[model samples]
Target: MIIKIFSLNLRMQGKKTYQEKLFACFSLSERVPKDNFYRQLGGVLDLEYLYGLTRAYYGTSGQESVDPVVFFKLCLVGYLENIISDRKLISHCSMRMDILYFIGYDIDDELPWHSTISRTRQLFPESLFEEVFTKVLALCISKGMVSGHTQAIDSAPVKANASMDSLELKVPKEDLESHLQKIRHISRMDKPHRQAKENKASKTQQTIDANKQELGAIKSRNKNWSKNQDQRPGAGNKGSKYTSNKTHYSPTDPDARISVKLRQSEKTQLYESAKCRHCPPCHHRYSSLPCR
Candidate 1:
């Protein structure tokens, strides 16, 4: 039994989880003299010109000075390659030497706090992201690889930040109020929810089913609010959504839509084919799409 356990442990340990592979492979075998992520970036973008264009927001008089270029590069990569959130991005950088090298941070350096990353993002406008993208495209143009004849674009369904199980379509007056009250009560009591500790000792998944069930019931009571609203008194109710369909999607469900669409961005006559805006990459393009 001890050997069996030992064998099982080794087998489990052998199961490899992929760290994010840098797919925007700025590196290649027959590399040109100038070949680094930034070099590749320069080949695809005009970094200095865009940075010059970015309106710098001065930090508070006493706040510690942050390296904006570093912060911007971190954010740029975070978007170019979709990681779910700033936390995951920083976590990857904290562990991966390649990411550390790309970001110009030391391998041993402590990762920036997730909150710091989020706060820094709020300091700039969306134009920064657009400018950065365009700069890269400019480099792609310089490489004489910019294709204007044909374009390919597609869309996919992505899970939203909010859990569908946590959302209600109609949210009846009584039900919405009830949930608000329940959450308030929980907040007031500040009950300790040590699910992690309990699971370790008991070797069972500590249940949040009760809370989840309660939320689910509230959602059911909302009575396909979207459907009902459209039918009730008509003013193009097809678009009348209190929240998004994706918002109610749950990350836990294996059956949930896994969105991964790749397409070519079209070329346009306008010098600026991109616009600047700060947004979570997953939802950014879909912002123009209707709620449905």
Candidate 2:
């Protein structure tokens, strides 16, 4: 109700900031003591508290003027808000009223430039993100926001980090099978999209070689199993002319399965023998999880 009530005198002041308006929305700047709202929002999160926690955990060495917390917070702010691209995120903080306010900046405050963001990220490892994330989640638990209960257990299609088009498949069902066929066709075409992406040559070469190696490993495993097995356990889960990626990559073409097995595990793995695109292939030699 308070958010809908705009206090901006556009005729003179142009507009009140989203941050300011947001604070007003929660009555953060009102007669209620700062402690009351601060308490309600949770706990004190001063610069020292932020920096100390990060400094102790990150264990970085050397002299630096900028606080590590600012860098960490910037990263948190970026990802949590679903602003995935760094450059676009920087641009938002610079121009967007709501972002600047949330990050403790004034309406006309100068936010970090895109280059600053690029440079700051170089200082922290990927672990820093996970560390800070867990801390936040713990706080949610402390506030009784999460139960870690089985009822809370759920699954959603986490699209492969691979482009959506890269996941195309085709089926003979002619009914809805045509839709899958289009997906498969599209994914095949999208392969070159990643190639055009100006990725580092070394990284690209490494990825290509890694995939090739994985394909070989999968082929070898499948060959040995086929020679010994009367039937594959996963084979029972298959539909006519459609093998489930739920366990392995069954291309629209059946022969492709001989060389490339797609194991779609809940472990977030995508193993394609055709190209070695493995999503954290389970490192278990005997982990009872079936191979396609």
Candidate 3:
């Protein structure tokens, strides 16, 4: 009985090997289900007009650019997938059969280079993008996917690539430690153990951008924040100190500004993209509509 069981176990064990083979009949359209989200989206979204609208942007005598329809579909995929990086978006699309079918690419076809997507985006004007957006919004409205009754504008703090340790004082001559002690009370745990190896911010960025009145307001706020924080439980263990963009700038990323969330003791450096502001309030009013 034991020998028989051992033989059966060996028979069940398997190993996978790599091999390549050509198929006589294979189709992406057939493989993807009818109810797939990309398939449904492709059915409802008609981007054929993009060719005529984008014809003026291209000249008659140069290498052909990326298909405007494909480019816009790629952008839509990126937005729907919440992929911020073009390289990652292309990589993601390559692996998904449904996405490939929606974007009109076969499994064997090579995708456009990620850099090409970036260049094409820069080549197109903002008005073209707005027109595309308007068309999609209009389609949504027609489908009862968006109602014009309510508007929901929302924002969240996205962490910047910079680190808190890379922060530098606006006034170069003032000692950071002495400055912190003067403006706000710091517990032993709140003290920084290390300093940035180098300051990369330009002289202009290091200069104070805030006026005297603004500086005074920030100081007053910092003092009040310290007093309020001391009364909270576990305040002694919190390492974050009140930081304002007016007084400090990130040497690693000059564009990053310091921000903190309500009821959160930790500070974060934030850098919001200008693209988020492109959607006007009038368009946003229909954002709360229900999809049928």
Candidate 4:
């Protein structure tokens, strides 16, 4: 049998030049697909009631604010897209045709400034947000997307804005040295550093409220934690020693409390440095211990 060999040629296109063009017939609604998520969401979600709900929050005079419906739609987009930053969310929304259409803005129409979104969010009360959430949840329930019978709550600890290094020992009525000797596992090599630049904590917060029994328990837990931590990698790292909310607090954020969570597979303890807001007394009591 005779054999034949074939050669294939591939064509490479040249660099394309981009330029802006004006078109009178351009329409954002037509550009986005009918089945697009944003399109369907926009069609089903009616947020016009927000005008009446939030009318009291606005003034009758002065400059006009961002549309309530548009602002909320942008927030919904951010939540659905998992965008945590306002600046980033605005930039991302500006780049998407579907998002612009969903928010009722044309290609040339400018989205509200990121700061406007933040200010608008703060302007609305928590009750307003809850009401909006309830309405959305009801919509979902009606659409058969939610069972409305059962709900699961997440108790995961979120990382705070405070740093571990900024933690300061809580002052007790007793001598400072004696108190430190009781609770802290001070390494010989650990050098003393300058005190916190500022202590924002009130006088009541500065003093340790934990009783002797609580202090003793903390001391015992610190000793064991220090011993086990020495076996782990980066053991000598600063801030590796266990510090409890019962003994230490962040000077930068007085309300922030230290929380710990353990990895099941590695059996290693991970500390969520601090909480940005004040937690309840019951929450603070359990937050110091390692969460499963």
Candidate 5:
């Protein structure tokens, strides 16, 4: 019998064979287009510089650490994707073939655990991240995306734990709960007398005296409530703690000072004062422009 070989034949054929394999030959990079965003970013970002910065964290002779370049690339992916959760970042990168190609991971390759990304972040200092930011900013400037000459500044005061209407005179530090309890007690005791005076049909000397006493109690209550307004009911969301420049110092910002703005009728407002520490060393104030 003579066997015939035809190399030019092209036809679809079905085979009754059970052939299942664990792996197949594939190229991730070739599957992704050259003009892809991650592809361009990979080419533009020079992550080799990170080696020197990360060298101290690794030892010369131990189990290898996750590649710093890959780690940072993943971080960039998170920012570009606007994914704040690390676990979601890993899952997102894993499912996308283009991202996998950009990160140089094979289809079947398992991604590094999400916890590794957090540990890597804590390992790197802020200064290193700042350095990377500066480089990226320079790149943007080179690309004409940003101009170094002009910058918008914010002159508005930062929101703090204290308020303008809550200013109090500095006094001896005392228990805030105790003060609140005492005020509440006074509130309860004076409630009946104030109500009775209001119910009186005619104004008399005794009623006038009661009215005077009620006014005094209300004045004192308003004064204390202004300083620790956060502690009072209807102040804010439930269980919110109160702090004042007089009784309590800001644990987060100890340098903050208290200032006051006096209004008509002797009403004063308390303000948590802080200066802009990040202002340029030499800047000219443009007072001519009206507030926007």
Candidate 6:
């Protein structure tokens, strides 16, 4: 009788597992070079100015608030790193030694919870953020990185999430007093822009003429409502391409406007035409019936 035996082939396999390390030398600052960009930023930026701006929001009797400077630094890290999600920003910062050093945190220090970042963001006024932005911009200008001259703006098309079929005719402005009031109220509730407007009123007014020109262009386009079906690029489907904001408006959203590519070439104006001789029903060429 032959016996069949199974032997396990287990030597040493590298598998992922969790283990507690009894000892380790951890120094975040030591790991990060002195010439690192974050370190350089920390050295150059004097964030103590923020404490005065943020002081009124904190109570003297309550538990300590997150350091205003550190909070802003964390926000800057998120912006520079392009980490839009708050949770991911915190996670990313936690993993980077340079960031920890920049934030003045020790290796073992636990970063503030993501919710804290959100709450702190809400608590601060927009002026504070603007102040930070202006300071950084001025610094960049001084460093010759950004020219404080004429700046050009650009945009790309983003398909709307809402359906075009839900569009409705716009109500006349004279009939929208209540609607306008509601919109103003909603705008007031959005603290950031409101506060920024209050703080930088003069700067905003300086661009009024430019804004008016843009508005006038939009108004002209809305009024004209040119047919651009043949001119629109990548128009694989057949239909009208341009719709006027004046003639058709989306009642579902006051801000929604139909946009089309305005740039066109003479080639885009190509039209298809056909001509054919009319034949009689009896298969003779145009016999007597006016020969249309």
Per-residue alpha-carbon lDDT of candidate 6 for residues 1-292, written as tens digits (9 for 90 to 100): 1232222333344589998899988777678898899998888887788888788889879777789999999989997897988999999988888999999988789999999999999998888789888987787668766542333333544444333443332323433555334333322232211121122213222122325565566445433332332322222323434333443343333343455444732111211222333332444443323321
Which parts of model 6 are misplaced by more than 4 Å? 1-21, 149-154, 158-168, 173-244, 247-257, 260-292
State residue 102's C-alpha deviation in candidate 4, in Å: 0.8
Model 3: clashing residue pairs? Answer: none
State candidate 1's TM-score. 0.41
Ranking by lDDT: 3, 4, 6, 5, 1, 2
- Which candidate order results from sorting by TM-score in descending order? 4, 3, 6, 5, 1, 2
| Model 4 bad stretches (over 4 Å) | 1-23, 148-157, 165-242, 250-292
For candidate 2, write residues 101-125 as lDDT tens digits: 4455565556666676686667567
Local distance difference test values of all predictions, in order? 0.46, 0.43, 0.74, 0.69, 0.57, 0.58
- Which residue runs of candidate 2 sit more than 4 Å off their true CA positions? 1-47, 53-66, 95-98, 150-292
TM-score between candidate 2 and the true structure: 0.39
Q: Residue 204 lDDT in model 4?
A: 65
What TM-score, over all chains together, does every model reach? 0.41, 0.39, 0.58, 0.61, 0.51, 0.54
Lowest lDDT sum, 10 consecutive residues, model 6, at 192-201
Please give the lDDT score for candidate 1. 0.46
Of candidate 5, the 10-residue stretch with the lowest lDDT total is 199-208
lDDT of 1 by residue, 119-159 (tens): 87787788877766677677766776653433333443443
lDDT score of model 6?
0.58
Model 3 is weakest, by summed lDDT over 10 consecutive residues, at 231-240
**Number of the top-ranking candidate, with lDDT as the measure:** 3
Candidate 4: lDDT over CA atoms?
Answer: 0.69
Model 4 C-alpha lDDT per residue in residues 126-167, reported as the tens digit of each score: 999999999988887788775433332335555555665556
Tens-place lDDT per residue, model 5, 138-186, is 8877876664444444353333443332222222123445444544343
